[model samples]
Target: MIAAKFQTFLILLTVLAGTALVARRFNIAPAILLMLSGVGLAFVPGMPPVELPPELVLLMVLPPLIYSASVAMSWREFRNNLRPIVLLAVGAVIFTAAMVAAATHYLIGLPLTVGFLLGAIVAPPDVVAPLAIARRLNLPRRLVVILEGEGLANDATALILYRFALAAIMVGHFSLPLAAGEFALIVAGEIAFGIGVGWLSLRFRKWSRDPQVELTLSLITPYVSYWLPEHVGGSGVIATVACGLYVSWNGPLLISSATRLQGIFFWDLIIYLIEGLLFLLTGFQMRALYEKSKTFPLDDILFATAVVLTIIVIARFAWLYPATYLPRILSKSLRERDPSPPWQWPFVLAFTGVRGAVSLAAALALPFTLPGGEAFPYRDLILFVAFGVIFVTLIGVGLTLPPVVRWLGVAEAGRTEHVAEHEAEIAARRQALDAALKSLDALTAEKEISDEVMRLLRARHEIRVNQLPDSLDPAHHDVSAAGTALTRSLIDAERKFIHDLLRDGQITDETRRRIERDLDLEEASLANREYREGPL
Candidate 1:
């Protein structure tokens, strides 16, 4: 059994790497390719079927993904866009769940409670695919922010609702006022606990002062924040998000430079692996679902899946337009402070409602038997339909989003704003460098540092200042680009020469590594500078 599981793991890693390469080569969204690849692999003759455990996704996979995204988010931006995010994250989730429940119950004749359970499973739009596609396509920053913010918080709403529906079905009773009060308490408690976790984690990392230990702490922080609240009957998502946002806002001052650099690479690679394996595993479950689905009438399952899928999609569209404009129309101050966006903005937001692994996990997590020892109603059917929804939305909306953006021409404004952002970045860099130079001058005057050391330090600062383009004009940008490209080539040549010296015994391996590390840092710095210039 161990060997088989190890072999399956290797197979998944191999497939993941190959599919990622294919996606990059063809300019396709990797999530879409990965899902399709998993499906294809599942049907291969003699292939072992992999069952994705519900707890694996809910406990192991979710926390870090949410935390990493939260850490990457700009807290100021998130706060500024809180209203829309709440509208989508909380209001839209409940509205969509209600819509799905109504449609499935009335149209398809599923029991109301069972329909609602399915609704909670499929309500929240998975932001992973949409955000990846949106960022690559250079969609509006505010739109991306809203999507990201919604993704971070919506899981909490949906999961809490899931619990409510489950209790109503299993225990055969639920109270609206009681559920509402409990929901509010959970949100408030989780947020406070999450922030406390963040503060404690930061203090420990700061005290430890070792990069390896700090990285370990960072790795565990999300789980600590997530598991505690969840273990105590709260939705852990809010706590994780709160912890991440707290870290993002305060971490720069507390975290060491070495830890920050290492942590960025560490988190990026971890997120990449986790997200890739998640989609692939999600796709693999189709085989198991297909087998279980045989117990039900095929037409009934198909109809229910289609109905739920349609309701979720249409529900987003129905809820978003009013959500976008209603607050602005009602409040004079809000209208003045933040005017309504164009119709295309809401349309694009609505169209990006792709479901993912979370829903599948929720459905699969349904208990096998209720408290009275009766089989769970519609468990198999719910799982089948949830998987279907993931399949259709992930592939359908993922593929069409690029063309939709193009057709709507929303990206043109984003592109223009992107260039302006780069220009502002250049200005900021110049100012920061100027400040550093002044500090250096002050130290030189007060501390009586050697003239040689001062000269070299000043020269280094000057070189960095010179690297910034004079303006975002085409000519200046071309010159800066040429210099950056040439610098990279020169760095590559130096690395090769260093390796040759090590091979010939002219330098020790340690010596070669030290030199190579410097070159790597320099190359990385150049790449970062170029990235700030934005896509041409």
Candidate 2:
């Protein structure tokens, strides 16, 4: 069993790498391309079928992905858009689930409880696919924040709803008042647990100055957050997200630069691998789901798929438009404080409702048989319908977003945000340099360091300061042009000298690599500090 599992994992990794290469080469979204690849593989003769265990996906795959996203999110932006986020995350999900459940139950003659179960399965959009595309497309900051915030929290809402509905279906009973009380308790427990875990993790990181140890803790944190709340009958997804947000807000003070840089590389690589594997697995499951549902007529399945997908798409738009505009229309204070967003913004948000692996996990998690041993009602049909929603929305909305964004003229908003970021960078760099200067003075007064070392350090930081643009105006690009040019020339000179030494056999290949890494880090630091692009 262990060997078989290991072999499957190896195959997954190979497929992930191949899909990533193809996606990059063809300029396609990796998540979409990976799903397509998986579908192709599913049909291949002699290919080993890979099943995604619902438990493995939920417990192992989900927490890290959610945590990575939450930590990277700007808490400030998330808080700023709290009203709209709550509307979409909580209200829109419940609304979409109700619409889907009603349509399925009435139109298809399924049980209402079963309909709601499926509704809960596909309600929340996947964080990985949309955010992946958004990052590459350089989406407007506000839109990105809203999407991220929605992704992080909506899953919790959907999962809780799914639990309630599934319980009703299985046990033949449910109480709204009881469910509401449980919901409140779960939420409170998750928040308190997340905060407690985050505080302990922060203290541990501060105590252990080892970067390697810190990275390990960082990797374990999400699982801890997920496990603690989940063990106590709370929402693990909410716990992980809350922990990520708390840790992210306090990270600068808790971690050192070495830890930060190393951890970024580790998390980025792991996230890429997990996302690729998850999407590839999604495609592979398509054939299995189809085969399992073949007992039902194909025409009936198609009709159900059409109904569910259409309802899901329309429900989002129905909820989002009014939700976006209604507060401004109703409240003068809200209107003055937060003016109405452009129509295009809300339209784009409404349309980008792509579902992902989480939905698949939920559907696959559905019980195979009820408590009395009868077959779970419409299990195959539910899986097929869930898959339909994922495929249609992911492919449909993913493809349409770029053109719609261009038409809406939101790229300028992104550019404006970039300029503001640059200004903030400049202020941060100024303070950093000031701190260095103060430290140098203190060191000299105490004779803790030599004058030669202080002089060299000061010169390096001064050059970095000079490399920063003097103002936020794009037209002022020339302000740091001279300093950046000189810096680039110096980096190039170092690189050339290093290579020459390697060619002349004065430095071993290992030595060359060591030197090259340092040079690359230096160039990266310089590029980040500079306003405009520079030669490496």
Candidates in order, TM-scores: namely: 0.99, 0.92
Writing each residue's lDDT as its tens digit, candidate 1 over 316-380 gives 99999999998889999999998888899999999999998999999989999999999998888
Tens digit per residue, CA lDDT, model 2, 288-346:
98678778888888999899888988999999999988988999999999999888888
Best by lDDT: 1
Error of 1 at 231 (Å): 0.6
Per TM-score, the best of the predicted structures is 1
Q: How accurate locally is residue 335 in candidate 1, as Cα lDDT from 0 to 100?
A: 96
Poorly placed runs, candidate 2 (over 4 Å): 1-8, 434-454, 471-514, 526-536
lDDT for model 2, on a 0 to 1 scale?
A: 0.85
Show the lowest summed lDDT stretch of 10 residues, model 2.
527-536
